[model samples]
Target: MIYIVIPVFNRKEYTKECLESLRAQTNQGFSVVIVDDGSTDGTEAMLRDEFPEVVVLKGDGGLFWTAGVNMGIRYALEQGAELIMTMNNDVVVDSDMIAQMYRWHREKPQALLGALELDASNKKPIFGGERLNWKLNTIEHLLHVLPDAERKGLHPVTHLPGRGLLIPRVVFDRIGLLDQKRFPHYIADYDYTHTARRAGFELFVNYDAKILTYPEESGERQIRSSKTFKNYYKHLFDIKGGGNLRDFTRFTLKNCPPPYVPYHLANGYARRLFGYFLK
Candidate 1:
């Protein structure tokens, strides 16, 4: 069985739209698991009223993205789900996207899969595969340069985002759930996928399977207009800030070779410092 696990904290309308899109999918073989992490916006009540068929898991609001998703994943495994898809609630997927992803999964049985995310306004890609650029200590996104035709084929990626990502049960059994304690919010998905890749899993983005993304409604995003020296230090370690320096440092130290960690950290700091002044 395939179970789609969604972690939501408020934004009832977005979640409602996401579930509606899933319900309209061409593939009727998948079930949904919603981990509502203390949504005060009547999201849980709405689910009970409208989409009760979806297995709903409640949280006390403390469980952030990583743990919230982990909770639903554990439930899916317990219910004999062979495949688990982790996705955010801010996307509207194409009707055939799920079926397309399943078909690709059948073809690449050992690979971790992600979907091409496009902006809702212009239908242009919002984000794609993220590859760590060690020299600049920043992530390079493929959508910025990928040709439209090339996107119609399979593209290998170093790090796949969590949105519309398909993960087989064996991966969880092998590497365990995402590191919630270390990454409560932002950096968890990249860290989890990196761990999976280290465990011999090939990560990829099947650009043919696409979804419309509401980027403005998504998770913590850094504001370039407010990138000042003091403001940078203020939210440097704050989990709500997208540019959490501590999390970046932790990710670097955990993934980079011991000898390169220092250099990467220094480079990352310099770039952020420059952004403050340049912008």
Candidate 2:
């Protein structure tokens, strides 16, 4: 069976919409496991009352994203799930998503599958996957590279974002759970997918399956959104902040070769410094 794992903190409305979309999927062969991490906003009660069929796992609010997702993934694996699909609560998937993903997985069972992300409002592609530009010392999302007409089928990628990603059971048996200790929040998905790619798994973005996402709610909010020291500090160190130096450093050190690590780090900080002033 294919099991869908979702980790949520609060935002009951978004979770409800996500669950509703999942329920309406064309393929009803999958089960859902939601790791509700200490949502004080009546999320647990609402789940019990509304989505009684879904397996609910409670957390102490500290599980964060990586640990919370890992908790559900463990349970899914224990239950003999053939595939595990990871997604965020802020996304409303298309009705044919599961069917599309299943077809893609069947065609390329050895691959790590990713679904295209579309902006909820604009319906334009978003962060589907990442490609490392070794020359520029930067990581760029494929959404910016491929146009709609060109996204015909699967394309090679280094990291697939967890928001609507299909991971085969063998990945868990090989790479183990996501690195919650090193990346409790942002960058964990990229790290895990990149590690999987390194471990002989091909990464691909299945253009057929897609999710409508709320981009504004992304943990990827840049520090340049504001010009304050606290924002800068969070941008560099906060667990929820994307491209934080600590987690990004861990990811690069673990993936990038030694000689390229210093260049990547230096270029990253330089861009942040320039971005802060220019913003």
Candidate 3:
């Protein structure tokens, strides 16, 4: 059976909506495993009272996205799930999303799957298959250039965002869980896709399976809002502030070519500095 794993931290309303959407899905052969990361907003209590069918796991507020997801993934594996779909709790999925992803997986049994994510407010495509340029250390998203009709077909991706990622049991068994310690927040998705690619697993995005999610704020916003050097430093280094130099360095060293590592690191620093000044 397919197991849906969601890692939630607060945002009770969004969580409720996400669960409701999942409950209304066309495919019923799935179970939900929610890892609540110490939400004090009555999320756990509400889930127990309203959504008793869900299997809830509690965390000590320390299990960030990666750890929380890892917890749910481990539990799903123990429960004999053939496929595990990890999604953010802030998104509303389409009714046939699971079925479509499962159908694609059945066709490409050895592939890792993802769905097109659209902006919840504007209904515009936000995240889909991305092309990574190792030489330039840049990523190009296909959402803007690819038309709607072309997006209906499966497309290969170098990296996928973790919002609506689907992984077969075999992929996890071969690659293991995401690197929680190294990438507690960001880059973990990129690392996972890279690891899977190294293991000869193809990554594909099924555009027909879609979800609506909020867009993340850009780094320039954070830089512009930093009023002091202290806050600037925090925004530059803190994981939650969308900055973690160590993790970024680790990802570059691990995945990037030896010669390109320094170039990428320099370029990243230069870009962020330029963004700070431009902001």
Candidate 4:
């Protein structure tokens, strides 16, 4: 059976919509495990009353995205699920998404799978799997390079985003769970895919399977809007914030080769500083 893991906070409306979409999926051989991170907005109570079939794990509001997902992943593995799917609660997936992803996984059992993410407003591609450039020490999204027709089938990727990633049981047994302590939020997805690649697992994106999600805002507006030093520092260091220097540095140092680590660190800070002034 396939187990779907979702990490949620205070967004009851989004969670409800996401669960509703899941319930409408074409494939019914799946169970949902939701890790509710201490939401005070009646999210837990609502899920219990409305969606009783879901397994809800409570948190102390400290388990961020990575920790919450790790908890759900562990629970799914214990339940003997053949495949585990991790997704953001704000995303509403296509009805055939699970079926398509499962079909692809059956064909390539050793491959990590991901689906295309489209903007909920404009129906444009927002996030998808990417190819890593070892020579340039950068990554490029597949959608940017390939046309819609060419991207329809399965294609290789260096890293897959966390939004709608599917992992087989064997991958977990070999590589292990995401690093919740070091990469508690941002860059954890990249770190996981990098680890899987190093351990001889291929990453693929099934463009046929799509999910609708909101677009992330640019950091220029955020930094420009910060009126106080406290707010500026908060945005600068926030894990969800687009430009969290500390987390980016940690991810670079841990994943990049020793020779590229210093270059990446310096480049990351330099870009942020340049963007701050230009904004």
lDDT of 4 by residue, 82-152 (tens): 79988989899899998898788888987889898888889888776778765476779777888866868
The lDDT for every candidate, in the order shown, is 0.84, 0.86, 0.84, 0.84
lDDT tens readout by residue for model 3, 1-279: 778899998889989999999989898878999999999999989999999999999999999889999999999999888888889898899898988887888789888888988888888887888988889888888886787679885899887878888888998999899999899977788898888987899998899899988665343355457567866676568776455577778888888878787889998777654555554
* lDDT tens readout by residue for model 1, 1-279: 679999999999999999999989998889999999999989989999999899999999899889999999999999998899999998898898898898899889878999988898899887778777665566777887787677775677877778899999889989999999889988899989988988999898988788998766543434444556556664465676566787888888887767778889888777655655564
Model 2: worst 10 consecutive residues (lDDT sum): 218-227
Q: Global CA lDDT of candidate 3, please?
A: 0.84
Over all chains combined, what TM-score does candidate 4 have?
0.93
Off by over 4 Å in 4: 216-231, 276-279
Model 4 score (lDDT): 0.84
Listed in order, each prediction's TM-score against the native is: 0.92, 0.94, 0.93, 0.93
Which regions of candidate 1 are displaced past 4 Å?
Answer: 133-139, 222-234, 276-279
Candidate 2 C-alpha lDDT tens digits along 116-163: 888999998776677887556767777778776888578888787888
Best by the lDDT measure: 2
**Per-residue error (Å), model 1, residue 107:** 1.1
